[model samples]
Target: MRVLGIDPGLTRCGVGVVEGVPGRPGRMIGYYVVRSEPGEDIALRLLNLDRSLAELIAEHKPDAVAVERVFAQHNVRTVMGTAQASGVAVLAGARAGLPVETYTPSEVKAAVTGSGTADKAQVTSMVTRLLQLDAPPKPADAADALALAICHIWRGGTRAKIQAAALAAARRSPR
Candidate 1:
């Protein structure tokens, strides 16, 4: 399955596309960072983010979209911006008719690094090792986006199978 992972932020939104199945190594298809100036109006910033995400979605044609869920932050402005960026990502996925799932930061870290409390450096190290890249992806946002994709492929694929099997069993069982 191909998945587009989004790490949303008003200034630097990270995007990564990954292809793989459950219990197998995954490869990165593409990675990009969408930038918008804070000096710009919110509307324009959102538009820029939307347009960039739309293009990425069209280019990648992912089966699913995994977005980093916005969590509460000490700075209200920061939280608001992140939430707005995240909304744009979900909208893009819906427009493309793809399943969209949101994973919290801790969840993503745990899936990629085997610990929810893992630091960014730890997560980056694991992502570099897992993708077998000579070096870690530049800019933490890109690495975070790739981590989101890897997490989804490893976790979502297994979840999907379990749901499908349950549905099949329910269909065959007597009510």
Candidate 2:
């Protein structure tokens, strides 16, 4: 499966594409940081982000999209900008008719590094090793985005199978 992972932020949204199945190392298709000027109006920033994400979705043609779920932060402004960027990312995936899943930071960290509380350095190191990259992806956000893709590739397939089986069983049961 090919997955596009997004770590959304107003000024520096991370985007990455990975392709592989469960229980194996994923290949990095591409990685990028979509940047929007912080000084720009919020509407303009969001619009630009949406356009960039749309182009990425078109170019990569991912089977699914995995986004970092927005969580509470002390700075409301920061959180709000992240949440807006995240919405644009999700919408881009949905517009492309792909399944979109959101994972918390802890979930992504645990999947990549086997520790939910793993720090950025740990996650970056693990991602570099897992993907067999020559060097770690830059700007922490980029690595985080790749980690999100790896997490979904590893877990999403199993989740889909489980859901399919449950649906089949329900269909066969007497009401």
Candidate 3:
């Protein structure tokens, strides 16, 4: 399965792609950060995000897209901006006919670091190690995006195995 993970922000949205079979660790396909200025008109910024996201999806042809769910509390405006960015990502994936799934920040951190409250540095460090990369993904946002993809692979594989086992058992059962 090929998966893309996204970390969305108005100023900088991150994208990463990983591909592998179920029950196997995925290799990174492509990862990068999309940058836009906060001062730029929101409409224009969103357009750039949308276009870049589409290009990535078309280029990678990911089977699924994973993204971080918003959980902002103190900054309503920030949350809204991030949410909009998330929507743009979903739209891009949908446009390419790929399924889109979201994992909460805590879920991603816990999967990647064994702790929901792990800090950015910790998450990034572990992501680097998990992928066997020599360095952390660029611009922090890229690392965050890759973390979401890793979390989905970890969780999705569990579900996929259960379904596969069920199918195998049914096949073996008497007609």
Candidate 4:
């Protein structure tokens, strides 16, 4: 399966794509960033984000879209903008006929680093090591995107296997 992971931010959204065998861990395909002017109108920012995400979806054609859940207790404006960007990303995936999935930061961190309380540096280091990249993903946003992809790979595969097993057992039972 191929998955695209998104880390949403108004000014600098990050995206990463990974592909793997149906039951195998995700392997990196690409990672990058999308940026918009910091002070652009919220509507315009959303529009741009939507467009960029659509382009990425078209280019990658991932089977699923995985995004990080929002976590904020301060900077309501920033949080709202991030949510808006995330919505646009989900819409893009839906438009491409891809299923959308979401994971929390702690979930992603734990998946990648085996620690729910991992900081950005820890996640980045692990992502780099896992992907065997010469250097860690830069600009925080990109690293975050890669981590989301990894998290989904771990969670999504487990979920899919459980679903398949349940279906198989159900079929085996007398109806």
Candidate 5:
């Protein structure tokens, strides 16, 4: 399955595409960071982010989108911006008719590094190794985005299979 992972931020939103099945290493299709000027108006920034995400969805044609769920932070301003960007990402996936899932930072870390409290360096190292990349993806955001994709492939894929099986079984049963 092809999955798009988004690490949403006001200034630099990381985007990554990975393709693979459960229990297998994911191959990186592409990775990019969508940048919006901090000085720009909030509405404009969000619009640009939305447009960029839309373009990526069109280009990659992912089966599903995995986004970093917004968590509370001390800085309300920072959290607010992240939340808005995250909303844009979700909307882009929904607009493209793809299943969108959000994973917390801890969930992504645990999926990739087997530790919910893994640091950025550890996550990057694990992601690089898992994807068999020559080097770690630049900027922590980029690695985080790829990690999110890998997490979805590992976790979400299994969930999807189980759900599909249940649905098929239900259809086979009497009403």
Candidate 6:
């Protein structure tokens, strides 16, 4: 499966493409960060993100998109920007007719590093080893993006199946 992972931020959105399945190592198809100028208006920043994500979806042709789920933070501004960027990612995936999955930071860390509270260094190290890359992806955001992809490949499938089964069971049950 080809998965595109998005680490969304207003100033620097991380994007990564990975291809592989569970119980096997994945290959890094591409990884990069999309930058938006702080001086730019919020609308422009979001627009730029949307365009960049759309371009990536077209270029990579991923089967699914994995986006970092924005959580509540003390800084409302930061959280708002992240949520906006994440929305753009989901929109891009939907526009391309691909499945979109979301993972929390802790879920991503646990999937990659076996610890929900793993530090950035730990997650980066594990991601590098898993992908067998020469060096860690720079700017942390890129690494995080790759981690998100790895997480989805390793866990998202099972989660999706479980959700689908639950939904089917619910539909069959009496009200």
TM-score of each: 0.88, 0.89, 0.85, 0.85, 0.89, 0.88
Candidate 4 local lDDT, 1-175, one digit each (tens): 7778999888999999877653354578898898999777778888888888888888998867888888777478689888878888877766665667778888989988999999999999998888778888888889899888877776756664454456556656787
lDDT of 6 by residue, 41-149 (tens): 9999998899889998899998788999998873786888888888888878766767678899999999988899999999999999999999999989999999999
Q: List ranges where model 1 is wrong by over 4 Å.
A: 158-175
Each model's lDDT comes to: 0.87, 0.89, 0.82, 0.81, 0.89, 0.87
Residue-level lDDT tens digits of model 1 in 1-175: 9999999999999998889886677988978999999899999999999999999999889988889999776378698999999999988886666677789999999998899999999988998888888889868899999999999899855554454456556657787
Residue-level lDDT of model 3, residues 1-175, one tens digit each, is 7789999888989898877654455688779889899889999999999999988888888767888888768378688889999989877776665667778888989988999999999999988887888888888899999888888787775553454456556656788
The Cα RMSD of model 5 versus the native structure comes to 5.1
What stretches of model 6 exceed 4 Å from their correct place? Answer: 156-175
Provide C-alpha RMSD values for all models, in order: 5.6, 5.2, 6.8, 6.1, 5.1, 4.8
| Candidate 5 accuracy as lDDT | 0.89
Higher-TM-score candidate of 1 and 4: 1
Scanning candidate 4 in windows of ten residues, the lowest lDDT window is 159-168
TM-score of model 5 vs. true structure = 0.89
Candidate 2, overall lDDT? 0.89
lDDT: the better of candidates 4 and 6 = 6
Q: Single out the weakest 10-residue window by summed lDDT for candidate 5.
A: 158-167
Q: Which residue pairs come into collision in candidate 3? A: none
Candidate 6 clashes between residue pairs 3 or more apart in a chain or in different chains: none
Error of 6 at 174 (Å): 31
Looking at candidate 4, what is the lDDT of residue 23? 36
